[model samples]
Target chain A: MLGAPTPVLSIGSGSAYANDRLAPAVAMADSGRVSVMGFDCLAERTMALAQIRRRQDPSAGQDERIGALVPLLRGYLSRGGKVVGNFGAANPDAAYEEFAARLRKVGLLGVRIGVIRGDDVHDLVTRLDCALPELGTTVGALGDRIVSANAYIGAAPIVDCLREDAQIVLGGRLADPSLFVGPICHELGWDLTDWDRVGHATMVGHLLECGVHSTGGNFEDPPYRLVPDPHNLGYPLADVDDGSVVVTKLPGTGGAVDELTMKTQLYYEIHDPARYLTPDVTADFTGVTIEDLGDNRVRLSGARGREWPSHLKVLVGVDQGWKAVGEMSYGGPGCADRARRAEEIVRARLDAFGSDIDDLRVDLQGVGSLFGDRLVGGEPTEVRLRLAVRTPNLEAARAAVHEVELLYFGPAGGGGATGSVVPALGVTPAYVPREQVRLETEVLET
Target chain B: MKLREMAYSRSGDKGDVSNICVFVYDQADYPTLVEQLTADVVREHFGALVQGTVVRYELPNVHGLNFVLDRALGGGVSMTLRVDPHGKAFQSLILDIDLPGGRR
Candidate 1:
């Protein structure tokens, strides 16, 4: 806990949904109340896709959102609002170079940028002594098919970068919540061993990490329609000091930040409430409490934490051949029956070709496609038949599309046929000793 | 009354596991939620979608119950061919469950 509290604002949440977040973030930064702004743009497979992009072109591994977001944040950067994020994805060095160049082009030169590295442990994965606990397989089994492997690093290096007076910090594959936690630790001077404070701050990071989710983005039960100005939903912010954090959004922005929204975001993607594992510490959210302070403000407290883990969690992406999908709709009377016949015909034709399909699924769109064969009864005037398949080779994957196309020739009424095939990237989790990975920071100036 | 009338929910996925959180509107209904919404009930409610075990974590202070369903979401967000790849829609699915004796 610090003598004075510091406010950290979260700009972007998920990778794909981050672009729309800049407006609200800039709006908040303009108020001059936030000390630091953090952006969490990397998901489990984001680095895998980024690595593929880098393989194609040596300088293409950075999160593309940075290019658009930097210009929008130029005013904030000039006004002394610090920034930190995992938008570096698979290549922090390349991302830093690109960002510096973009800044210079916009005449916002001389901004100090820090790049944190060493999250990529692709070379050490096979030699590591640990194994993937979930799959019951050793790292050696992943072989040469592994494209990218990164350990989820904590906030120490990020704090070190901040201490060096870096205006912007770019990181590769750091833990999502650490983006926010790093700033809090740097500002409040909280020790890593302060379990209670760290735990309380981690909850604040988790709530703000998803941006609008804590501010009414994907909130459905209360029905988003009731949320004020749902179209212009605000991003989340945390006013943290003395281990106590109050969550709220920009004052005039459109969104609700009550207890319901906070609770929903608290449990999002967490496996165990008692033991929420991370590189920094094993946070226990079970003892946590939330108080609705009215308006859009909620207060969170009582989050307890234990010691940090000996091993860091890593995500490994392996090339898994190709996947193909095709969809067509059947309408008018007996649409469901016609859709079923179309599926059977496509399955029989694909089987006749003897294609080496690893997995094949035929689903009736308006029926039970999402739940798989659990159809609730109702007569539908139209039904779309969707065929999806995965195969070890592109030839087999393409054969699935060919079979679905034949439906137009024989099926009674099959229209709107669309298909696509792309290489699949499969992800698996592994654990590696913390000592095996070294985190280093580099400062670059425009 | 439907569970949606009493509670609100939010869900997300990590690998093949999907977690859905149900937060009752009133703190007084926390006990009823804990007793009625069990692992077995959620596993049965999800049916074939959940191939493995279902674990429920209770947070009495927040009046929230988190249901972690294993082997759900077809495969996961990146690998799944389903329309709702991240299983974000599952929150509404679970919230639609029927509750006995109406509001607490």
Candidate 2:
């Protein structure tokens, strides 16, 4: 007996931001209309960092913010509002155990928590006989340097867990949109093979996946399309039934939801409008249309879908050596000139030291750093000199940082000299046959 | 007039590629945007920041043109030494393009 027209709310969007999203989640839950609340906390770099944490501590790797979020949602859980999230970045089992303990501590007992694992294919990645389409290299060529490899699993496992009466679902390295799609599929009982319905649902998931983005958080026309009470911005919600969705937010909350806002989010991070790939289906947004339904609500429809791809996209994190960046600001007249001199001095120092830096860059931040060789008009009163270097050896990276620190003593008006040397992790995109990876789901009770 | 007077833009990045979408507020401005905003014009506008090819995709339903710049962001956010590694600020550059209509 699933809710036919399920109202899904997106609570948290990015990776562990400081804002208190729990308050809005509580508000949406108190309405007694939301059947599911999904949190998307995993990003490309965030997953890579989670993998590093997992290597350091076996029990860790989940989003730390989940520890604080679930306890606050106990009231909602008691009200029968379900939760699905990818806060279990690299360790779903460990995250589920920790979440269950927190739930019991808060006196919210007997809550069934479902954990979805087996997305990680670090060991099996090297054995795959396939070449990365992006880099044109075989998986075997990557060899032992691959630290973490996880496929973007879809919504089927999540729907499966919800069918078993699990109040909460946790997954690791799953596609972000699937966090929203799972609840939709479970409530609607839409077949995975139904490309049209799946695609429409996926479009809804994408609109709500970023939480506040669709609700005017990062809207383009700012002052014209004002978002009232933006500091306390409200998250987005989708009321869905069949294949249609109405995108809206909690009533009387901050942020505006309209056609412009929805349009911007629709094209966000999307390369091709016709072939937006996900584990569930190949969503086609070309024919999609949006209509303002009034009062911060818009109707989205006509999203078609094709068959799912034969291979799953896997993100692999590899150690790419060490990188160091140092910066110092110069103020008052002739600041750009002073910054240029500082850069020259640092480059001369590195050159004199016989440094074997792989990629070295020096730029005046206030002048022409972002545009590269393209110079902007006029001079600035203040400029910051940024020098960055990548080296195979940590000591060399530190030496490069030291060179920028030396700028304070040599160059005039040089201040705020600071820098950091950290191990660099580069992401390599790969593909693996869908059958090569297995998705496992387990229900745990408190 | 500047392009911002007629359109709004948003930029995003994937690997080393950066895509900027310029959406016209008025439907009538779509043809003008398509005519004035070509791949060559975008390449010249971005200059050296984009070392590779620039391809444009038009979405008539939304009155939008998406410009994909390759080899941008130096080498993507994670590896690039750029201050704006995500290329989030690049939208303003595209919006600053001059228009023939003069402040529509």
Candidate 3:
């Protein structure tokens, strides 16, 4: 028999599948078994891509999938299910405007939705320029080149939406873990001082953030890989109460949801067992335990958390000078050895030409030794050599790579350097972390 | 040793969980450092600082080692604390592990 209906139910959508994604959550709400339904569409790596893409194309449109999900989210709200989604891309304000327009189109004007701003913490980029006594580094030197900055807003405003009687909550850039955090604030009416419960929810949020990852999508088990469902994988849901909660999924789903999946996801981002850092709070990933309750239900309790760090871990990319790389393929009897020999020849030639190479990075893709760091024991018949060079001089970086073909025509190893040689040089931005970032929240009039 | 990259994979729910794989990165002499810093080695090294049984697994497919420290983090680990609830202790603890490669 099912226990008490959870006041909050989270649905983690792995990716922005289309506007119609709201249908699944709608069905759950129709059953009258849940209080709030959330959809997570952001990908960890996708955020990086969005940062790079936005730099080049300032007006890039919303991702096709995210665009489609907006209206469907509006429809879910019209149907009486309190919907919340993370459709905010690099431009959350833009996404919010578009979503607001969509709500207006459906005759559901003035929906009174909430958008958690202030997480964009980009301004902190400037503060990190000068080094503080505690941090011992300059701002611009540390996180000055942050491509994108975001603060992980907590659940205060999200709970505000529930109290405001808003039907939906749309966030532009909330941390994936906060999706779960927002709901707990609505449930327990706990203040930020409730460290233990907040810690428990943070752990739950982290485990549940990746959706299926906690259910078997990325488990290390060779025999039971990625849970069960390959195509129709179900999103994870948490029925939280007090200091614990149960993780489960819709019945008959393909993926596997057991103790193993949860453990793996927990280990994914954890460093020390005592502290796990996020904008919301710092949790100890090592402090968690999983109890598999058979038939797709697992209970989580005793997960504790500590106060958030004074400074968030900022990933700022700055001008690390310039780097250019090109690739050449080689095959045949000594193909593996030949590829290495060709790279050496190019380096030799570049050095002979007075190349002031600050750093020369060579990647023998199949060889597995790209950064000259890791070396693989076995060698394949063919090898692809991706050579990169970093220097203050762009021409030198370019000239050093331009010699790839010279080796192909030179006596060292000519046959292996085949196919088109393309230039791959891009400037790397330095990364810096500031002391603190401002996190603000706003309740939107839908 | 520096904690270079920490990657994770999940299986089931909260309770009755199987294993949490943590890959530790050392300096150039990874294997030698790993041998000394194996879960058992770590458990032995931090015996006074920590408690419970910790197991180490070798991942040949990837160029790293995995540590399965059972009930060692004072509580049932994640069950006792949230992984993403922000805090300084987690990072400090990671920084506290004296490594064969070097000390933080």
Candidate 4:
């Protein structure tokens, strides 16, 4: 069965909680005779969300969905398929254990699983903390206010999983694109030394990393026209053979996998195509080409890449403290003028009373208030003025409200009260690349 | 360490800043595959690729490297329309490298 190579299938989601969003794609893989299933999840936001959930419900700790997502994998496994994913966020070991337990309960005994680690590249943050040569002029602007850092993990560890005969592999905090790239190299028997093809696979992985983004779900220019269903969009699949790859989606699904969509995705989250960075290598995206093969399919080939350095970047978040904001609207002739005057009064009041308004910004909506009157862009006439302040002191931040009431009596004050004050959240610390977190690769008897 | 491609865009008025995430991996025979695999080496490698003014930092605690390739991609300080969009795949192409274990 493994000889013909059951079309290798993979799925990627934008968030950790997108299990439902990723289900359709997984289902399609099963129906299309896919042998292995993998998920991409290096989203920092997802980690933050998982942290919140862990704190609230200790039982629902890390790997919150192993029981949920693994069962689907087991169902496929029952049909002689395999599953793998980077469901491990801040804690991959914990996720792996949970997955193993889930499999044990389902009677999938002796399921050899592997966990890939050693990608926390936070040491660079210290160097960056002292002096960052890459940021140039902007380095001084940020000062030492960076919260977290993390190194982008690559596909080498995934290959380790393949070597161990693992039916399933889990990763903690790996780059989303790496999930797709690893399997392609494994299936095609492509050598890691083959930088060109590996880079091409990485390109394909990047295109579909955000799940439906490449399939025209989030596209903008009268965009991809992703058919059948856009809201409940289906993820894409890269059916490859020889030296080429065809991007497509399942039948009776929603999404466009054509040249335009691929092109749009290619340019989405990229900064420099010439030196596209990852945990693997510096890819040359400009050297690649794309072709639309009709039927929601696009063929990608002719890509090149280079060797990576010896470290990973770590992203970390720190406790930045709390903030609160309140907005009030003003309409009429001098509404814009009134908003500005009110803001000045509030600032003066807070400043006079010993309030900790470390970061204070009041935005005038209707009247286009540019950064120093260089009004190049913005809504010409804003009707609402949003006044936001970030302070360590909660009482002081609340006391600033006095300034809002005074605005009504000012020159532009035409409002009584329209909106309520919204409290900003206490920022949490998110840490990035921190030491090479080690994981021993072992073939579990299960 | 050369400019393989240039993707610029005027997405918003948020200046022409490109956030580069360099990937560095360990050699196949390396004993401890730490964050070092994706740090300084990756940054310096790509810093050369863009052929632009560059700044770099070593995230020791994170075991990775970061580089800020400045004025590299094309974009306008104003206008939300990113006249040039490099897309994420472009970055993947340039940073593409081989795996340690070769092909499975």
Q: State each model's C-alpha RMSD to the native.
A: 2.7, 3.0, 10.5, 12.6
Q: Chain A structural similarity (TM-score) per candidate?
A: 0.93, 0.92, 0.76, 0.75
Evaluated at residue A310, the lDDT of candidate 2 is 88
| Per-candidate local distance difference test | 0.79, 0.79, 0.53, 0.54
Could you estimate the TM-score for every candidate?
0.94, 0.93, 0.67, 0.66
lDDT of 3 by residue, A1-446 (tens): 99986554443333332233444444444444455666665543344445555666775423446445556555456666566666665555656677777777767776776665555556665755533222235545545443555444555556666777766666645666766677766666766547777787777777667666655654433432335555655666777777777887777555767765655565554444456666667776444556779887887777777776665444332333455566678765777787777777887777853645655656676665321222235657777777766565667766765687566675444444432222221212223342345444566785
Single out the weakest 10-residue window by summed lDDT for candidate 4 chain A: A423-432
Q: Tens-digit lDDT track for model 1 on B23-91?
A: 888778888888777788777778888878899888887888999988787767666777777888788
Ranking by DockQ: 1, 2, 3, 4
User: TM-score, chain B only, every model?
Assistant: 0.93, 0.94, 0.47, 0.42
Off by over 4 Å in 1: A1-20, A133-136, A222-225, A352-355, B100-104
lDDT of 3 at B97: 46
Candidate 4, which CAPRI tier? incorrect
Residue range A1-446, candidate 2, lDDT tens digits: 76554544333232222233667766776666577877777766677778778878989988787778777777778887788888788888888988988998899999999999989887667776456554557667767656778888999899989989998999998787888778787787788888888898889889878777787776636554577788767777878866577888877888888888888888877777888889889999988888899998888888999998888888777766788999999999888888888878888778843656778888888788777655467868888899988777788899888888888786788999999998776666677888878888989889
Candidate 1, residue B97: the lDDT equals 75
Task: Name the fnat for model 1.
Answer: 0.62
Q: A50, model 4: CA deviation in Å?
A: 5.1
Which ranking of candidates, highest TM-score first? 1, 2, 3, 4
Instruction: In model 2, state the lDDT of residue B6.
Output: 81
DockQ of all predictions against the true structure, Cα-based: 0.67, 0.59, 0.08, 0.03
Task: Enumerate clash totals for all models, in the order shown.
Answer: 0, 0, 78, 104
